[model samples]
Target: MPSHPNYSNQGNKFAPAKTSLREAGDLYGQKEFHIYQNAIEKMRAHDDQLPSLPIITLEIRKATSNPNVNLNHLSSLIAKDPSLTAILMKHASSVFYRTADKPKNLQDVIKRLGMGAIESLTLSHSIKSLFVLRNHQLKALYKQAWQRQTLKACMSYHLAKTLHFPNPEDAIVASLLSEVGTLALLSSLQDYAAPAAPTYKILCQHYSKHLGAILLAKWGVSPVFVDVLRKTGAWTLDTGRLLQLVDVINLGLFHTIHYLQPQNDLIPLQEIAAFKKLNPQYAMIKQQKLLIIEENISHILQLQKNFE
Candidate 1:
């Protein structure tokens, strides 16, 4: 297990809370850990339906050393899936790309945006397209999930540039797919009846443990991404510069939403602290940066509408 330089000595205080959440036992008075163990067993039995996509282990293996393969080859791979191609074209014509004219075809769009951006677009679209959940409740859940993911994708690109990460584009792709395990679980909720109007926190707490491991196994996601998702909530001096940027972007979006609508969920104070620590200049740069990113994302969404 290759650990990030900043991850050392960061004790897992959240681990115990995770235990209690998973166990559904006395939570406070359980003499032994067996009650919690039994609860985990039951949850495991219910969590059988993983994402239906085949594991692209070959892609993962190739990605580490030579991520910059030929664009035509990459485009061909993405074009095999119509939904993903639509998503890529939409993103390419989006405000992020800033082309004067909308692209007329997938090849044109891929040529315009370049391979790095295409990679992120393909990964984001593929995960969303893979697990089709049709229930009204599940649809709402996925909508929120997509919103969070889109926000993260925008923020990751901005943060990567700010932190001077080696591959800002790759950072965006990583951020986009960071919570895929959640999607895998949500895809299978039809198999069980979950309570209505679930909070993001509750849903994550309920399924993260098992789902995280399962997604890593089934999707062939890189170990680096898995590690980042596992420790996303933690704050430390060494949480990797790129991950720190991710944390700040997530917090910035939360605060931005909260300020716009007071009724929105309260932003965590620790998140604010982490954001401030990671980017001391965030206060100075946020408004302009956010405007640019949101405009791009909106453009992408608009393009998607035109296609529909």
Candidate 2:
């Protein structure tokens, strides 16, 4: 038996656990495995260094919670960060903002995006900056994780549309932010001496979702999104045909990796319980997986460009 390789950076949590050759065909939860216990213990040491919830994000979330809240004050807070303000400007002009009445200024962008879109994009741009690590090797690893997340986001959006999900944007945000725990774990271990990549991955599997939940709660991300984030690690956890954000991302993520690995065979959609629950025929997914991923790749990147 060969060792199961965790897909570098994509962090596809849904596949069957990869067993080491020594433990071939055996099953073990990486999170509960004892080998990486010491590495997992190190995760909490740098909570203080984890990025603080950006103030503008908080203000916007607060405003969203209160119907009577002053929109001007919320817009003012966002405008304080010129970079964020610029991102909003670009988004307001995007096709996602397909209004005959184009936004003329920051206030218009605010009105155009509303509380939900604003919150998603603000946190996406603001919080991701916190992933920076002084260690060059760790920094490169973090970049791969972050890029994988963008693709996941796109896939979630497309999957939601295919499945007729009520709110695709929420699914996209949940997918993108689900990897925060992995990012935090990498940051925590960046300075750890001589970490074997396998050991590092074990620690990641054990703790990434939990860390993501903590960061999202601290950042004031809505619990709906947080619940979806927490559920990503349970790749096979399905709740019937009533598809939610978690299911959307799980299916999207599985296909995203399949698209990326054109030369190799992927786990069939028929065998994946998550894909089966969506009511698409096994043959339908096999036929359309590439187009689903490739089409959404352009759409998702275009959305990111709007924020860029």
Candidate 3:
């Protein structure tokens, strides 16, 4: 039989031996686990200074609720952070929106682009800055990871819009932040390595429950958004159309990054199946999903180069 190009002949060095979910739970139950708990607690205790500029949360809520919110106010808020303001300007000129004649000022950028576009650009900028890698290898790993995240954000945004959701911008923001817990854990855990590490997989598997609890206690993420991310695995559309879209986008993006194969002995098929059933649109386009993933990766890499 011809060997599959995508399959590696190397034995699964990253795989963990058979362990029941209950056993995994017991691992966390050990006394040593409190080390991580304490670390998370300490990190959370530090006040999360709002980045030098206003975040998307403030801009979106004001724009959506108050039609009278002017471009000047939004512009001034963004201008407070030079880095974010630069990102917004670059995005405004990117081919994605076809504003090649780059807007001269924040007000021009806001007036020319709708709130949704501005919000997405802001989200991309914010997420890119959250985690910084010191080593080249880890830097590449995080670059790829962020590419996957950006794709998820784009897919979620489009999915919500297609589903006629009221707050597609919020969905984009949620999808962008959903994996923040995972990033947080990776950033704090010095022993963890990336690209191919069983420990990394284990960390991700437990992150939702672990980080969700920590974020709830430490970060003041809205209770509603937290609930949406926590219940995402259950396929609960009742949370609202935007969240449902976020759930499916996350599933698709994750499977794409993992090559639709189980990693470190973690079987993600069930999660993928649940998401497909809940969002039939993702299922129907499964064949073309890889194309979207590749395009997103290419785009993000280009963006990263510009920043460097």
* Leading candidate by TM-score: 2
Question: Distance (Å) between predicted and true CA of 38, model 3?
Answer: 6.0
Higher-ranked by TM-score: 2 or 3: 2
Model 2, range 1-308, lDDT digits (tens) per residue?
Answer: 12222333442433334435454212243433443444445555445656797667667667766778677888788878888888878777865566788788877888877776777777777657776688777776776677677766767776776666766667667887777777887777655552455555655655776677678766766787887776663556665666667777777777667655543455556565566665543225445373555545666667655533
Misplaced by over 4 Å in model 2 are: 1-40, 45-49, 99-102, 161-164, 193-196, 233-235, 263-265, 277-296, 306-308
lDDT score at residue 290, model 2, on the 0-100 scale:
39
Off-target runs (Cα >4 Å) in candidate 1 are 1-48, 52-72, 101-104, 161-164, 197-203, 235-274, 277-282, 285-308
Model with the higher lDDT, candidate 1 or 2: 2
Model 2 CA RMSD to the hidden true structure, in angstroms: 5.3
Alpha-carbon lDDT of model 1: 0.50
Better of 1 and 2 by TM-score: 2
Where does candidate 3 stray beyond 4 Å?
A: 1-66, 99-102, 116-120, 131-144, 162-164, 190-196, 216-219, 222-224, 233-243, 258-283, 286-308
Candidate 1 clashes between residue pairs 3 or more apart in a chain or in different chains: 6-238
Candidate 1: residue 298 Cα off by (Å): 6.1
Show the lowest summed lDDT stretch of 10 residues, model 3: 1-10
Q: Which ten residues in a row have the lowest lDDT in candidate 1?
A: 7-16
Q: Which pairs clash inside model 2?
A: none
What TM-score does candidate 2 reach? 0.77
